[model samples]
Target: MKIEKRWIISFLIISAAAIAGLFWPEAVETPEILSQFGKTEDIVPADVAWLLTASCLVLLMTPGLSFFYGGMVGKKNVISTMLQSFICLGVVTLLWVIVGFSLAFGDPIGFHIDGRFYSVVGNPFSFAFMDHVGVLPHLKMASTIPFMLFALFQMKFAIITPAIITGSFAERVRFISYLFFICLFTLLIYAPLCHSVWHPNGILGTYFGVKDFAGGTVVHMSAGFAALAGVLVLGKRKNSSHIPTNIPFVLLGTGMLWFGWFGFNAGSALAANGTAAMAFATTTTASAAAMLTWIFFERLNGRKVSALGACVGAVVGLVAITPAAGYVTVPQSIFFGFITAIVSNLVLNAKAMKKIDDTLDVFACHGVGGIMGMILTAIFAQGENASLLHGGWNVFAHHMMALLLVSAFTFFGSIILFRITNAIIPLRVSEASEQLGLDISQHDESLDPNRHVPMTILDLAK
Candidate 1:
């Protein structure tokens, strides 16, 4: 069989880049920057240890997400769905190391407003090929841990965001085309959002005062809106209805995600301190509350409480609480969990949402949950981060503005990326390929051994 020229070209490009990377010079840190934070001796052992553990935990979440999504798709599509998530561990990592990390955490690249420099994105050259990213603490970012560790932790978040979008168009998406879309989404969308919200001098954080303790806006919201755009572009699966391949996998995935989220939320503190402990407590409290609220809410709606409902609710709580985990009290987290579950459930059941054919309810569970999280964070934040209830109208107003900005950027930006990917290669598989199932049609693999038997042979035997 002849190999496609595109595949050969892609191989050559990757090979050239890898070889060039080997010759890239090690970045030198200036004495002024090093003294601004602390010397390498100031790096706390506990902070480094905690951050290292947290980084591992966050990395585990992607595989957990794979299992979580894999069990929800039809058996014929399970491997394809899981692979879509798993592949990010490889693809996004390389992208992040090369330039994605710089675009997210490098020096400010936006214009000055009222004499304050508000960065829209990071300069790609500032940290290209991990330049200036070393074991030394960053002056502005994380001072307690190595700068490289911070980048590594954030890379996991970047990897998982695009993986989350795969669920929206699962089963029908062409794997190669989906790969291209993720590359675009991560570079163009996820990196910029990360720069805007999480970077110290970012536009949303410094200029707008948006308080995303973790990544409610950067990760979940972006994934949710992008997923919505994908559903619109891919259209519905030929047969949209199917029994889940494995409920056990969903439960397992949920458990893993919950366990890892302690790191996802608490680790944002970059220290093993009181803030991290509070974030850990709030994370679990919200998830438990959401789990119970979800099942009971379903019962009230005249639907039986199900394992699936419980899992979805728990995850929604996690999403909702993420932004406020360190900012809110335990009681506030419970409220966050309860209200977010109710709202996301309602959105999931909305007749209008039903028409969109978001295959796995990604927009409803993640997108709506993230939106609720941001809204609630704006209302309930306390202390120096006071919000509406605390008499900070300006904070509330800016959050609303930031919300609109993020929604438009992630949604419309994703649509354009989808179109570009489709132009390069079709986003949806052919109808025949869809009927045959993506696992077999795309990967030439299947869960069932008998799947290899030709239909004609089975018909002849029958």
Candidate 2:
């Protein structure tokens, strides 16, 4: 049979279409035996509109995260924190277009679902999707948009990841080190891992049966571990004890994050129908639960819950639900959010228990929450293969183990990259720079009223 180039690309994509089946610990294969409805030629405009909107929504989350993170830090560091998220959008978007997407979805790249690549499976060089010069590849899940838009949406995930790392080294990191870490982390740490879980040709499906409705494992846990590694490398901020800076900004950031998240979770459904509506419901419920949980814990354990606790609780809920948004019920989501709030908050407060100096509790919130989501997905996924809970419950432990492996992989990669970036350029600001604060030291600006002219009626008159 003579194979057209288009056919070759399509065939190659079809062969490599199941990466998350491996360490997924419990992938929902929709086993051939279970039954499936054949593809309909009917075009769905609603689905298309939903996906396009969702991509934009996910993109907005970067700035939303910036505001959230910036508010938590001192006034001196606001722009720096926001800049980290914004820069991630620029760099990772470029990288994904060039090679990150292909690296993840193209070939095995030495990763396997079990131990070896199967015949139906393939190597990067062997896959048509791997060849950037061929006709653009298409995914059934998102055929409505230009593949470019799909790539852009996924790129948002990569962008926000390193931004999560900013919380660990916020006050003291050098700009050069920050740039160094962000570039390398997106490529080495994030790319392959994304391939493992989301890439059509991934190990997650081939090896373990991990089920991440969104990014409980990849985005949250991975970034959380990176946060831990970052603080370990950078040490604590100069001032550790007090409120350190502004509390009002943190509240403002949290509000914006909550607003933008409607798009983040609902949009993940990649459609605007029932599942997306369900995700929207769970997202709101879990956030509310986590926030109240934090206040209760604070009142019981500490003197009172501060502005920081409320904001962080909201974030933890968001992180925990990311991986299981479409799969679990609201009751399960509430359980997931509440548990994550308690656990992550404790880890952060356990402070000084380990020498690592996380600047803003990234690991406690994002990392821990992500792990909790991934594990619960295995327990609560209700469709297709569902979890063993559909019948038996043996797979729960396997789910935890998978999260651990992914966390370990992300942590080690982060540490190695941190060391390499440190060697290339110092990873921290000079003591003088730290004293000056990143906005002034790195960007050479400030929030001071005297620094710039105010926009008054007289100024407009000019």
Candidate 3:
């Protein structure tokens, strides 16, 4: 279809939906608690304001990631690589609104046949189409923000998680297949992990007391491990060249991701309180420390400090601190950043030596960093809650157990998902098409407008 016709159709459909929404029974009422400005309220306005702002910041990270990943790929595949992340913004958001949120955060379903299953996942029907997820504060969850806002905030995380995996098979995967796999991944892998770790009655949280201040396990580790699986399934790119097309774009993406990460970590606090403040401070400290540590290590390895190394190191720091941001102090985060940068750097080097084609080092940065963060969080998590450093042996043990379980589940489950998606739509593109470049073969687009010179009437007639 022509682009103009497509836009007209989309506009008409959206306009019709807006008109229909105005006539529907008013199920979504602004809560009385939020309406009162001058009096004491159940929902704090400050919390609402902060959470909303944080949500927007988190949303920006996906495009930031697109640029980051895009710049790292060959110029021939940059648009294809970027679109893989950009499409998640649209595809994942729709999936979340439909049933994804319910599956991850709706009321837990209990079984009494034995002791209790407690809920493997939230009741999908309970909040299907966001039935009760409205402006009213969901007392069971964040009590200060609208339930709808909370869901929307969570949606940003959902959008970015699968986007993270595209780095694994950037140049070789078919775009349609990529889209299907991410959608399937969100429902099968991402949602279940989110429910298990974050939901109040979740197995890991309620039964194991595994603490993930943000999404060490759910987002970072899952994406990382799943990325490993994707690399294994998709195999190596035909041209496994490590040449980066755009260092400046990588820097821009790094800056955006670093900015967005404040929301990614602090927003998990769900309240504008001391915890949020602590999280923000720790996130900043950890990222800076990691960036410096990475370049320092590069110098030691006899390689000149490069822009790509700094960006990757900064990102690794952000991943390492995510699980500990709200729980640990700034000094602890400095250690977290420094240690994680070293660990990821070592693993990345090993991966390159082994010739593993995990493009962009998703597993090395997110997976390894997240596991390190989870373990560190158990050691240094301060406050009233006890950590291993404070004699909380059981909590430490549970986090270790949770880490293993999450790693195994994500890795194996992603393999199964890749096979399933591949059965329906071939995952890898034809070698001929890949040689021609995904930009021209798949999308008929390119970063350089001059790649296709204009054809004269004589050429067209020919």
Which candidate leads the pack in lDDT?
Answer: 1
RMSD of 3: 4.9
Q: Which candidate number maximizes TM-score?
A: 1
RMSD of each: 2.8, 11.3, 4.9
Candidate scoring better on TM-score of 1 and 3: 1
On residues 1-462, what C-alpha lDDT tens digit does candidate 3 reach at each position?
235453466567657655654664544434653342222266788998999999999999999999999999998899999999999998888778777998999767654335756566788866666666776677667777888889999999999999999998888998878877897899989988899888877888777777799898899999999999999998888888858999898999999999999899999999998999999999999999999999999999999999999999999999999988998988999999999999999999894624878878899999999899999999999855557998889889988888899999999999999999899778998886677778877777788887772334213211
Decoy 1 TM-score against native: 0.96
Q: Write the per-residue lDDT of candidate 1 for residues 131-187, one digit (tens) a residue.
A: 877887876788889888989999989999999999899989988888888889999
Write down the lDDT of every candidate, Cα atoms only: 0.91, 0.71, 0.86
Residue 140 lDDT, candidate 1, scale 0-100: 76
Better of 2 and 3 by lDDT: 3
> Is candidate 1 or 2 superior in TM-score?
1
> Candidate 2, 440: how far from true, in Å?
1.8
Q: TM-scores, in order shown?
A: 0.96, 0.81, 0.89
